[model samples]
Target: MDQVQESYDEFNLNFRIEDTVIVNQTEMEGFNAFFLGNQSTCQQSVVEGVRVLSYKIPATLPLGQFLKKQLYKGEFLSILSNILNQLLYFEDRNMPIKKVLLNTKYMYIELSNLHVQLIYMPIEKEFTDCNVCEFVQNFISKIRFADMQCVNCVDQILHYLDSRLMFSLREFYTFIIELQKEDILKDDIDLGEGETTVLQQMSYNNITPYLVRSRTNALIPIEKTEFLVGKSSECDYQIPDNRKVSRKHCSFRISNGECYIRDENSTNHTYVNGKMIQPGFDVMLKNDDYIRMGDEEFKYWVR
Candidate 1:
């Protein structure tokens, strides 16, 4: 997605075309290259007594209307999956994404199946003025999730968008897929990939989790299910004045009496017992495990 960008052609027509000037009627025929035939994804039509051509998606509501209302987490994920898959398809075909409409109103969806359909012009110019990030920001704002996993995911996405100067759709798609997978595997953090969640509740009410600074012996209690450690002030445990530490470094996920540590792609990386842990993969912490984030060291304490 980063490799594709829209550049202006200086030699193109600058003068405006008059209303009476002959224009290709096929230009008004929506996506697919065929006439106003109802098919998968998008439908095209013209209302009786109306001169203007139209893109009509039958049996679906505009995403703006479908959204801006209460939606389940599953519905949200389905919509995103459909849209991103289409964008990826467009990218593969070398189609001009700028011609693809990103607005919620232009995108259609069916609530029951959470189907998404986007309008794309085949013309030799960009149709919509908005970018993908702007559309996503607005789209995300309207979504309300009932779970902490989703809430945390939304916060992380917003933070990522704000911190970065340039946004890539492909990168965003990967991050979103990770977020979705993480959400799906939240209950089964101990399980391997493709494993099912057992959904048994573990009683850890008597026990608590905490961390200790190895050098200073400062005790910091693990208060949240998802705890953050980084150089940024926003983190729960901020390691100050560390150039090697990323703004949002490692994360601690306390689940079912076990503490899972994740390396958040930090520069110097995160370690467990002197071994470098893979970034983005969660490693369960044991009693008195030696954990290192950049130059700072800590000991995971659970009782």
Candidate 2:
């Protein structure tokens, strides 16, 4: 019965689109011809190669009026489907959507229930994997208020939504872009026919830990064998303003190309990715891991 139920559940699950669309020989040939023809033009002007699409839908049309119109709901759904499909297509191709603008004619969509306009610009890059819809959804989910203003500027929209969200989004986007660049650099350096690059070998030999301070946006390279962290001035990495931080909070060190952090028997203790670690016990550090010392938080990056 359990196995049967599991099978039924699996059958009912709506899977996310993950695979790229397969093109036929004719489609491929046409794409090649188009690419070759436009190569010169695209090289000359980058903006000309970018595609921008926009759609407007009456979201606030009264339910009664919409029902009376008969095909309003269908039309609305169709437009939304097209937008989603375009986003998914770009995502599959690893293309960055340059911009996505959402507007409701200078009125809040929740208040007016009137209309929604979506403007999207998709720009193809040699290597980019940004899902515009996912970013929008993630950003929207962080909005504290149900009522949102119809704003043209993405930064303005975020400002109206939440400041914390804006800061977090900026940091996250930067981190992702940096990671992508690192991956691209690694590929360029390492990719060859049966040849291992020196950079690739060095990556395995060395462990470089980086501490990204949230408040100051300061990036500190961890080169020493042991780095002390605390609120006290005596500590290596001092957070004097942070009252929650103990005098001698914690310490981190790199050993055999692996980074480890050990709690230093502090008042508030040390945490890695939210879970508190045992005092004096060393925890192995991973790339892009979050570390919390008392009330302060730091993003750890190992390169």
Candidate 3:
């Protein structure tokens, strides 16, 4: 196996936990019967009816075996394929869940008007362990099917991907999502409270809703940074000065550390921590680094 493959194998074998949380009897019952083949039996009786099924599952039953019944063979196949493909072809980027909440108000009415009955339970973590548990959680957490027709949300996702001119829908969607995470190492980390954390500064024009920085010095735009953070190694900003000033410049050289600032070579110079830096000088920054350009003064933080 290649070195990357070997590392991934090691990670899967030793680091990541495969199981997710699962609760509920119906799903559990369906899962058991599907996997154990309805062989071992148990019994149940209600006010109106009696049902016989497998005896209580032994506590020692393997999680993989339990989930095997609850999860489809096809689901297993697809997950395995994706994992192998990602390991082989893509750099793993940190990402948050891509969720689509169904519009229960209007869409449900429309479906009901059309006599289309929809029933779906949101995907939940299975209590039992399995290799694809994380993948399952990622998939289910990202998808929501309401009383409305399933096609509606799918169409929206497809259109969004198409609008981006994504060559491969799956890969592009995944990459975009991964790149959109709030970077802890960034000069500006907004915790959403009265407090702010600045890891680095972007140029004034590159300012984004989630971050505050000057864009005039920004070597790259927030849109591109939002999509390229963890996936690419191409540097957008260059250090004009060999002299390191403060924590900001040093962070940029470290792995996973990133910052944005206006270049001194341009018409404007980026001032950090009340110091006006000249062209070609590198500055190190920490949380709450104060930057000034012209009349504007801003603070950066980690959110």
For model 1, the stretches where C-alpha displacement exceeds 4 angstroms are 1-30, 33-52, 125-128, 187-303
Across 211-250, the per-residue lDDT of candidate 3 in tens digits comes to 2445443333233322212111333323333223221221
Clashing pairs in 1: none
TM-score of each: 0.47, 0.34, 0.20
Higher-lDDT candidate of 2 and 3: 2
Ranking by lDDT: 1, 2, 3
Please write out the lDDT profile of model 2 over residues 134-192, one tens digit for every residue.
44445333333322221212333344223221112233343333433444565577556
Q: Give the alpha carbon lDDT tens digit for every residue of 26-132 in model 1.
A: 43343554322223322222234332223435335666767766655555766776787677666666665666768775666655566676666544432433456
Best by TM-score: 1
Off by over 4 Å in 3: 1-148, 158-220, 225-234, 245-303
Q: lDDT winner between 1 and 2, please give it.
A: 1
Worst ten in a row by lDDT for model 2: 36-45
Looking at model 1, residue 13 earns an lDDT score of 10
- Judged by whole-model lDDT over C-alpha atoms, candidate 2 comes out at 0.46
In terms of lDDT, the poorest run of 10 residues in model 3 is 105-114
